[model samples]
Target: MTECDINNQTISRPGNSWLAAAVWNNSYTYKVSAHCPLHYCLPYSTHLNFSIPNSQCQFKRAGILCGHCQQGLSTIFGSSNCQKCLNIYLFLIVPIAISGIILVLLLFILNLTVTDGTINAFILYVNIISINTPVFFPQLGKFTPAYTFISLVNLDLCIQTCVYNRDDYAKMWLQLAFPFNLIFIATSLIITSRYSTTIQRLTARRALPVLATLFLLSYTKILLIVSSVLFFYSKIFHLPGDHTELVWSVDANVPLFGVKFITLLIACFIIFLILVPFNIILLFTRWLSRFTLINKFKPLIDAYQGPYKDKMYYWVGLQLVLRVVLFAVSSLDRNNNVIIGIVLFILVIGLHGTTLRPFKNEIKNYQEKIFIMNILILFALALYNHGTTNMTAVNVMIGLAMGHFILIVIYHIFTYALSGVTRNKLQLHINTLVGWIIRLLNKNPVHQSRLDSHVMNKIPTAVNYHEYREPLVVQD
Candidate 1:
């Protein structure tokens, strides 16, 4: 896989960075081009300026430029402005996630365990020289000297083991990890496709940042996955010694133990690298007021949170969460794993399409009914799961669709009716319940109008004696 020479290279965008485009050898499993020219992109610049890049968007930091001659910006997955990207992420993720789990579920159903696991290892950095090793010296000849031992190693040569009655989870997940990475690769490619090609401008640079960002995002999941498999391997196959029991098999014939050791070491380093910043952010958020957390996550739910964008974003997130729960349950050694997995699979599929239902039929009343149904669905799931009542999967699916519908509709009610400041406080405080009851029992809030009272009028005249004046005898 060599990069094409300058002679083989052609201009991509009219005025964009040339480095954005790169051609790999035929051996590469996947490829992605860029599509530029989206209006109002969150470029790594002040006010979408193309010259200077900022650290705000992860894509721009990775050198993914605009498809158009324009460059220096990227809309990230969780960015409030990039809800579409989030939707795409979830859309791709749903199936990919389900695929691996489905394979595991199948294995469970068949009661089969196939053996598969990673080579487990750790580094033993002997700061001091090793004991009893011969060291060559001019003056001190043929002396046993302590020397540091730093070596990459292969602990074992055999690769067999995906089969296990109880260990299938680890085995199946291990098998799927690398292949599952292809899903991430595909996701990155889709994001690349978002950078549409223009007649004059090249957008290939956008792929750089998109790929980088995705790789980082995928890191934690991958690390955890690989580490889990490695740990599983160590437990299953290892040198039966007190000190080296957790490491790969120490047999001399086992090939490339060094490579495996370094690989594991690098993996551990990657995990460490990934966790540092996240922990920083977590600590910072904790240090900040409670409102910071809300303000932070507000963007992902921003546009669709209103009546504006597609409700599918919210639905996708919720559906993914539910799918996770279902998978968790399915992983348990229970007969109901099949039934629950199937039911949740249907829900995951159904909820996605549920948003496509005619909006006209989803009037306010219908929406309210959806909210009520969501409340019912919760109870129904609990009851059905516990065997309190017998309900078919279809019935559960219908209930899920209705409940899913409620996600979009309930937000409107929450924002409008319940969110803002309200005058729920009493203007007039009543001391006792009896007083309020007696007060309400009266026909009128007040017994009578204050204006109905009798009234008297008087006029005063001023004179010398008492500031009163006398009238003349004009009538006589």
Candidate 2:
């Protein structure tokens, strides 16, 4: 077909009138001729169309623009501006691509003929890396690189909102992160559930999946709650001087309350409703299991028993959810109040963990305690240095945090090295050294007199010794 004929044919195609009208409306100076084809602009447009009702526009329906609108927008605003709108998808794609690769790798590793311990250890290493990445590189917080490696994990959303004052781009990335997180969580749960019998048979051989599940679940719950608080609660119940950005929109009339926000609020409420009763039942059943009188209901109790790790998972998960909620609420406070609230919260958690020893492994419990202590100290330093003109306190806090991490690494190395026979030998040496130090420090006359008396008591009487000595001489 001739170019003129093709142009004529394209202009005659359906939806051209809407595009023409949008283009004319957007560009008052540009007049649309009947002979001009819409394809001369661009193939598509994802921008909103004000010429029609929001319900009629594709951008309003989906967060993306329709082809007709894209053409109209390009015709009016040029192709460069239109391309910028398309670049947003790159943010969505990058994380998804990375997560897809990680997920595939995990599946492959899980299928390998490896010991559960090895798999669990590998997973634990990955989880540690995922959790600490954002801590080390705060810039990646916006992109949420943790979600890809660990599956559905995120840093404190409340901190991201209050401290960072994340812009729309970050919000968009978060919105994208949520679904990918859900998919990852769901996939992990399904895979782990399939291995539930194996996991039970192996006992503590498979802990990472449980911990990962709990961590994801807890973080997901926090994400939902914090998102709802940011998008819905903060919007409806505005606090004085509260200028925090909403997850969806900053303006009141933007109609940006999309399906995702509403779905988030609903999911948050549903989960809360379900979790409350479910946890009550678990707690009540657990309590019942402790009583000897309930031995008749052993089968029923056993059904609910789950794994010990599962219980620990729930406990740790609950702690995480509670901590996040408190932090989210406290983030509403001004000045250094949030930091103070966080320090207090961490202190309470540390005390609880120390007293309860939630983890099955004593080592894990001790490690967590040390971590909490380190975090508390760092936060305390930060709080003291807040609003200070000098960078010394900030530097000190950073240095201390880094040093604490190094200490933890060294501790793990020592712990690994001091296992089995080496550990026993080390313990004997330590005891000897401690005893020698005690003796060296007890040089005071009163302590010496008491020690000499104790040694004398340990000896036989002189009369008994003389009698025993005479017996020996008689034998000679």
Candidate 3:
């Protein structure tokens, strides 16, 4: 709870996990770089200089950061006046958790059911160019390929025609993969860095959900990598079964099995490369924080602290090392998939970002960022499929997904830009604007006046009035 002066003088506090940020002036405004809990420990190389919190309640109020509060508040009010805190979990987090589970399940089910030719085509979805002709694609007439889809009313699955069954559409998806993955990776790295910073500042009580989300993402990616490797590596097994027409099975003994294997290995490697160095730096920083005082490193650390060049070198170098390691390890996949497993672990680590935060801010954690990213990425994929194919089902999905994507993107981007001095004002404004959308989706829209009146009643006179706005709180 101690605040530093504007003079930049060192004011060290002992055994204080509560105050990680250095404040200038009495207002508790924080230095962005000094916001991580381990500000006293090691320097953060991957943290983003996004808007920092400016109030005491930010650090004190239920341990939620300004950003996450906005989201939770949306959920709270998304129902009716957000009558209880549980609504926050129900309205916001549950849907995302469910989506992630469904996504993982879909990946596995699709992998298991798709024909070997289809699996080969799926792997080729990232290839720069297509080699397969229409004949290679397993389709009935032209665009529609066959799959078993459940009929909602009958609760029965019947073989139906879908664009995903088309080999050409799969190839088209790969054409878009470069930009899609590029955007996804870039955005994911940024969010992961943000999550790292948030986790550091979070109290044990506040961090439970964030930690769980991180673990979930990690587990999901592990499953994805394992499933990916299994599907691709199966070419080597040459298992006797009903299916033996896989052209991918041609290279069973090669180091990575085939081009697709190399491609996936490289993809996983790239993610691991991003994760390793950042986490290493975090470990080093934490270890150093406990031993070194400001006075000891001030003179030396100050030299690199002002300019961004050397730091950039460290940052950029670490990123390049990811690429280097990926290619390096891909050359030697020895020891019974151990290397693959190790890389898979690294990919999961890399996909998740750095761990450090000054004010246990839930503003944007791994889950929110990853959830948004996946949705957007899916939009890009769905859009591509819709455009390339003539199937009615693909077009219908695209129609729905694109519309949802556009609405969510617009609503989120617009409201996220709105910040207020008081959590009440911020949440109220945010909840009022975004809450309706949430309700609409949940199919339980309350009258606007009712919600406003309810929210007004919940906020005491001292807390709600704009004239007596709450000061922003940033915790460490």
Candidate 4:
């Protein structure tokens, strides 16, 4: 063996083996991005002359291989740690509790009906006024009508126009849609861009896992974007104008097959739209958690290098787009079903916002904003629903509102709970990858060879981490 001192001073005496010693202090910390071929090519034990006769005995006496030394081999020292399973009980339990509370409230409201009390009459008057206020939609006359759908459209138009002349809700609804939709799209785009950049910048040894996570995120984003577009197109199939007169089914029991088809299409769109976003968000979150864990052991991984790494601006942009789109698309019609669909769409967008990369940082604030927005929107809806053409029409609007509320709540709970479980599964996968990386780095081929020599002096044996983990070490 040849040896050199800390200053690269080589000592070669007559007939004696050469010796060299170079102390790599903290100042010479490993540069993960740099090409340090010598350190990588030579096994640690061999380079340090730990194979000298009696060196193992000395190691034992010095307590270098004891419990304290074993700590160096801990999972914490690896590139990442295992992810703990997320507690799903909280997600499943809390919503059920809230539903029970709401059920009680619903029962109370249902049982308090009155025939002709002063307050009842007042409510009846208000409900009547609400029903008949829609001469506002251009198609509807200058006054509300007796038909339930026509009256509801009238009430919506009144709210939008403060009268029955024009579609008032259209502009606000359009504004709401664009910003909300943009939230998920923008965040997803940023995540993809940042991930690609990270892969390009990373060195070969560290690039595999980063590349894998990037691929996962990119694929997920693509799926979501495609799904979102398909869902919107599906909604367009269910035209805004009433088509009862165009019913083609021969059977009286199923007069409007178009309606049923549209309903099924909408349901499919809603399910796909809801599931895709949740799936993508959960996957990204798992990747993020893995990044966090790996960051602890290898701080050079550059978790904060991406432009979208902070992500607050991404969310704000999404909000802006949602607002614009919502305002535009919401004006096509004001049928109870249509309005409910629009509301559910808005809520879905809000839920996507909650799962965006930086959402957790401001979840409470976002929740408050969503709550306030929903309350105001609902209040307006209530006032609009009140302007029916008749008392019976007003009751129908109430039923529609109740049904919409129930559907939205149920959809939200299912998506949110599923996201949690999906995130947990992703974390577990990343953890496994991290553990593999650490083992690949520290295992010494020379030591393994020496042990093999002792076990099988005459047999040829091959065991290598690089072979299993990557395309062998590349020499630049």
Candidate 5:
């Protein structure tokens, strides 16, 4: 053991593994030790000399040990192997850590419809719309396939930029996310198909449950669309890397059979596979209507008639096409071109929605129009701020977009709150309050007396009652 003395306090170095200090304050002494083992490093080093031992290390109280402390410990122990072992451990650990997180999230999303059947259609639609928005705006020049994948979870895996390469990490995430999203999409489709009859029955009995299931199915479909689009985009616009080595690239065709192949498959699946049941029902009902044997089941066929009649599958397919177009335009790597493409797409969809009104609910049709208008204005601002160097204008546009998003969210929430009995009751209360106020205001003594006098002045004094009475008696 070695001893050092400072401020009448004794500091002791016990063995090669630990440094201990006795601190004196208010006639009390407390011992604090830095257990700097040869294999493990403590972030903070204890100053052995001071009465109150101060920490001399720069690292904050984050869980991981700092490099300086590790190097210091390794130097004191005369061993260079500690850093190598730590690096190997971290190399093995990071992927496992991120994979665990992804698995948890995947499980949660997969179970969302099953565990919670009360999800609101309006809120679900708003979420789908918001999340499906381009994570990287081309005008901002931050467009990267890595960013698109990272934005899915919105997690900051690396706090320090130098710790890990972001592009590589994004590639890892893409590999993990692709498979998980595929599983989610497949499971969701199967579950929805299995419950199709149940949903139809629920439709005739309880509307809310049916709407929730339908919205959930739509959400899964949208998720599939988003995943497929990103996968396709990544294949088309590759980063400066060996494409043959990357798992998500078209050249690295292994599990996906190729990114382009999978994308085409998904597109066809979205356009046709999901519509198979509806087509079957339509064809079956048409064939049955010809034979009088199934005339009694006409009512049953009518229950599933709305979607086919509205040609809503075509509308959905159009949506997927438009999304693909938007992403393709964004890949052109030109800000103004992207903005113009967005504007044109919005115009086309706005026109289509306005004229066709795919939704059965009139409110939803109007809501879609309002949402399109807001998005159009936001993109217009982006276009105006395209070539400008003014930070203020850019910030203002971003703020305006955020404000519009908030307003749309609030509108959806307000609409959801004012539905069914709630809206009716609120209306009744408002009408009652207004009627009460009017009656109270009309109860003014001066006004009432004035009205009575005005009526008195307009009345005849006498004589007319006799002629009126005679006519009434002779009418028989």
Candidate 6:
């Protein structure tokens, strides 16, 4: 058939008959059309008017639906009903769950495998290096190479192992270690300064030497963090083995590993840094024997008033001094750090509780505020201990800390909410009384109109209502 006739005319043929038209050209141009109404091919008359071409003209057989529909059908029939469980399945719950699992696994690996050799070496070197004095300050001595290794390469390794292998716990610790250490340093510095200055002025002696030594100890805390990170990476991921492992114990149940040993060593170095100066002070100064609680308070109260600020600053200063001393004593005997830590635990709680007392009337509001402040403090402390602590142990510590913080947070929220309700009620009563007064003063239209005009024209007075006047009383 001709192409022109095929395009214009509609014709019916047998069920499987095909139609082809060749155009008038040197080369034959064939066009094939099919009609298969049983399988709804090209088209059959339904709501729309179109013809279904015979299947015989088709190159390949056509199905009712595409491959996608087939697969969908198979899934529907073979798999469980996705729609029925879509609320849980379609949401981000699965992705979050999977990510959480992966994060936990990484933390597990980091906690179980990372070592602490580099940290111990650094601690030893810092103590040894600082022992020689100011000439070795910026210069690289024998200890300088290890210090260089930590700054240049160990940092990256710590970050990698902590972040990728240990992830959640590592990141958490890294974030917290810096701020906490800073707090400790600042607190220690303040106490040391106060102690030295007080001793010099009161006793007619120079305590600068001892104070300077105390200053040296603050830096060791930072070194400890750095060393821990380095040691973890060097031993955990880069060790000579196919499988890497982290092996620090966070709980009483678990045995301590090299990392823990390093951590303890770092703690010891910090003690030495603190004690060496105090010992020097003790040797020269008979005032050390006479050092009493009253002397501490005299310096403290002389500094501030208002119980809250006084106690806070005093407690912080005291804690710093005590921590340094405790750390020193503990170095001589580790059981001592634990005993001191227990004492500190009690003192911290007492001081923290005292802070809450000032806001007892507004407990809820106060608690919320306190919680936020504590969170910041906790964050700082955590940063200082990051790679230095075991991942699993660190995580548990953080979780418990957060729970402790959250309890206080919830308490404060309710307190504020109650205060708000009380304030609203008081305001409502004031509004009602004002409305009643306005209604009671029902003057004539002219008087009322004049009063309104006068009110708008004049400047407002200190006294709101001019209608009521009272005799003034004067006192000699």
Top TM-score: which candidate number? 2
Clash number by candidate, in order: 37, 3, 18, 48, 0, 26
Best model per lDDT = 5
Per-residue alpha-carbon lDDT of candidate 4 for residues 385-410, written as tens digits (9 for 90 to 100): 54333344444554444354345446
Candidate with more favorable, higher TM-score: 3 or 4: 3
Q: What range of 10 consecutive residues in model 5 has the weakest lDDT sum?
A: 75-84
TM-score, per-candidate, Cα-based: 0.23, 0.41, 0.21, 0.18, 0.35, 0.22
lDDT of 1 by residue, 1-476 (tens): 12333553322222111122222454322211122112222322212212232221222332332211123222231111211122233254455466544533332222121110000000000100010011111111112111111100111101221222212222224333544454455444445556644511232223333332223223334433444334322212111223222322211112225774456446656655644443344234323325765466443223112221243223323322443354344323234544554465455335524654312233532443343344235334543555322334423443454344345335434433442232232323334666887666554634433222322223343357543546555566
Model 6 misplacement above 4 A: 1-162, 165-313, 325-333, 340-407, 414-476
lDDT of 2 by residue, 62-96 (tens): 11122223332221110111221333334544655
lDDT tens digits by residue: candidate 6, 156-231: 1111111122212233254334334433443454556566876334322212222222233334454334333333
Point out where model 3 deviates above 4 Å: 1-219, 230-261, 278-285, 288-476
TM-score of 6: 0.22
Per-residue lDDT tens digits of candidate 3, residues 95-132?
43454445333322222111111111111111100111
Candidate lDDT values, in order:
0.31, 0.39, 0.31, 0.32, 0.40, 0.33
**What is the Å distance of residue 308 in model 5 from its true position?**
8.8
**Off by more than 4 A, model 5:** 1-309, 333-336, 387-476
Clashing pairs in 5: none
Query: CA shift at 62, candidate 1, in angstroms?
Result: 45
